[model samples]
Target: MKTIHLIVHGHIQGVGFRYFAQTTAQSKKVTGWVKNQEDGTVEAVAQGTENQLQSFVHTLRSGNRYARVEEIKVSEADQDQTYAGFKIIR
Candidate 1:
């Protein structure tokens, strides 16, 4: 398993971006936490198989019809984060 840091940009705030991400991560059995950034972006750190992480990123791009994600910055994280389930951090 691996940890990936994702920064999603564009019309993502106040449009259920965090919820969608959390739900998607859970459905994929991924461990992570998502939060709204101060710069109006959505941020998440997902830990799972590489394939699962890719799928999660794909969902962030296409699964959200109501939320238009313009760009996503993804990178490998230094360590694995233990999370029982995905959540939207306030």
Candidate 2:
């Protein structure tokens, strides 16, 4: 399994980006938690197989109808971290 920490930039906040990430991650069977950052970005940590993570990233790029994702900064995260489900952190 692989874990990645990503920061999504652009028109993400106030646009249901966290819920979008949560739904997409769950659909891809990825375990993660997504939240809105104070800097107007969306941050998430996802754990899954390589394919699953890739697909999840792709979906995140597309975003919801209201979100215009400009960029996503991704990096390898602690592989030891695990989550039971995808969540939208308040």
Candidate 3:
């Protein structure tokens, strides 16, 4: 399994981006948490197979109709962290 940290930029906040990400992650069988950052960015950490993670990233870039995703910064996450399911961190 692979874990990745993401900082999603653009018109994401207050647009249900966290819900979108949680749905996508659940569909892909990825376990993680997504939350809105203080800097008007969306932050997330997802764990899954490489293919699953890649697909997740792709979907995030596309975003939901209400959200216009400009960029997503991805990087390897701490391997020790694990989650039972996908969630939106309020």
TM-scores, all models, native as reference = 0.93, 0.97, 0.98
The TM-score leader among the candidates is 3
Predicted candidate 1 versus true structure: per-residue lDDT over 1-90, tens digit per residue: 889998898998888878889889888888889999899988899999989998889888874667988899999897735777787899
Candidate 1 off by > 4 Å: none
Kindly report which residue stretches of model 2 are placed more than 4 angstroms away from their true locations once superposed: none
Off by over 4 Å in 3: none
- Which consecutive 10 residues in model 2 have the weakest lDDT in total? 79-88
Question: What's model 3's lDDT at 88?
Answer: 93
Query: Against the hidden true structure, what lDDT does model 1 obtain?
Result: 0.86
Top model number, lDDT: 3
TM-score of 3: 0.98
By TM-score, highest first, what's the ranking? 3, 2, 1
Give lDDT: candidate 2, residue 69: 98
**CA lDDT of every candidate:** 0.86, 0.93, 0.96
Which tens-of-lDDT digit does each residue in 1-90 have in candidate 2? 999999999999998889889889889999989998899998999999999999999999999999999999999998776799998889
lDDT, model 1, position 15: 81
CA shift of 40, model 2, Å: 0.4
lDDT of candidate model 3 versus the reference = 0.96
Candidate 3: worst-modelled 10 consecutive residues by lDDT? 75-84
